[model samples]
Target: MRFSLIMVAGIALAACSPPVPDSGQGVGFGNYEEYQKQQRARDAQLAGSALPPATAVSQETLAADGTVVASNDGSDLAAETQAALGQGQSGSGAATAAGGTGPQPEAVYSSGISQENNFDAVGAQRSIESDAAKIAQNRAQYKVIEAEALPARPGGDGPNIVDYALATTHPMGTQVYRRIGVNLDGKAARNCAKYASPDQAQSAFLSKGGPQRDRMGLDPDGDGYACGWDPGPFRKAVGG
Candidate 1:
């Protein structure tokens, strides 16, 4: 009876106790160890595929005297650039030699006139003395032309009208000669129409009994003019 009671108490105590938790089935951070293992694998893969480190550029340094210390790596590049420049210059020279010649200098011309703004320079070239000398030279070349006598009239029995015009001093319309006829104005108009000009009429009138005698009745009022012939212009020309 005592042994059976002890066995029953042990079974009851076991049934009432809380269950033991599974290592893989906890509420928080139960798979933290597995996560750590996965993280380590990814890190290993990225490390294996990483790029190589970049090369460092060579830098120039300044000396204590403030002079630049150029890098040795740049010396070869500078030498190659200078060699290319020298080749280009030589090629240009060869092309110029193949052509006939290079550009020529511009031609300059000299002028008699001065280009300076100095008034004294211009005054020295042209003065009152120079102008007087030029005037004297022109005067020495000048010649006075004496008035020549008029040519004699052609041989004709008729009186010269020019002489009559120069001789007359009285104004026109002053009765100079006696006129007696019927319709003398009408006769004069008809006779004057026979001549081409007043001068020609006067010449014909004087040729045939004009001023003193009315043969053709050309001088109607007998002012010694025929067909309104004017002597004023002829007198003015000679200052009579």
Candidate 2:
């Protein structure tokens, strides 16, 4: 009976305790030094098995004379290019005979100006005597236009504002004429709105008893000008 009770107590204690985890089966809690040694061995093996060195490539280029040459030297390439240009310029006739239809050297470098119409070319071709003759011919064709008085303002009853502007020497806001009425400025503002521009307002004012009289009230300040119109520009035009 005592032996059986001891055996039963040992079995119960084993069952109550957690089971021990296998290091190889789950997350390894094994030798870190061993793992490092394995890694170092793998790196060394990879280093020893590196790929072979690449072979040097020899590049060949075609020369201008239709021959394949090794382009190892830069000087050789530049010499070949210069030789090609010289051959093209010197042997253009030979190339044309061999079925080449490219533009001639002259056409390629031409300034696009025809020799006949170019001023420098024409000047080179002309003699001093010829130039003097041409100048005389041109002068003979030219005519001197006599300055005539601008034909008296084509007879119109309505006063020409151009004439009025030229006639008036007074500067703006000089009050050349007399103005008397209630709210003359307000009347002018309202009346000026009816015209498109100050010039139009002045023209209309002149036609309907303006300058001397303020029938339309466009010239509120009695300056002979209407709707803030200035005669200075017109006066200046004639050098008045």
Clashing residue pairs in all predictions, respectively, total 0, 0
| lDDT per residue (tens digit) for residues 46-75 in model 2 | 999996568754456776698988876567
Q: Candidates' lDDT values, in order?
A: 0.83, 0.83
lDDT of 2 at 139: 97
lDDT of 1 by residue, 81-192 (tens): 7988999887876777888576477999976656465578978778899999999999999999999998886786688888899878888888889998799999888988
For all predicted structures, in order, the TM-scores are: 0.51, 0.49
Model 1 scores what on Cα lDDT? 0.83
Minimum summed lDDT over a 10-residue window in model 1 is located at 55-64
Write out the backbone clash pairs for model 2.
none
- Clashes by residue pair, model 1: none
Error of 2 at 8 (Å): 29
Ten contiguous residues with the weakest lDDT in model 2: 22-31
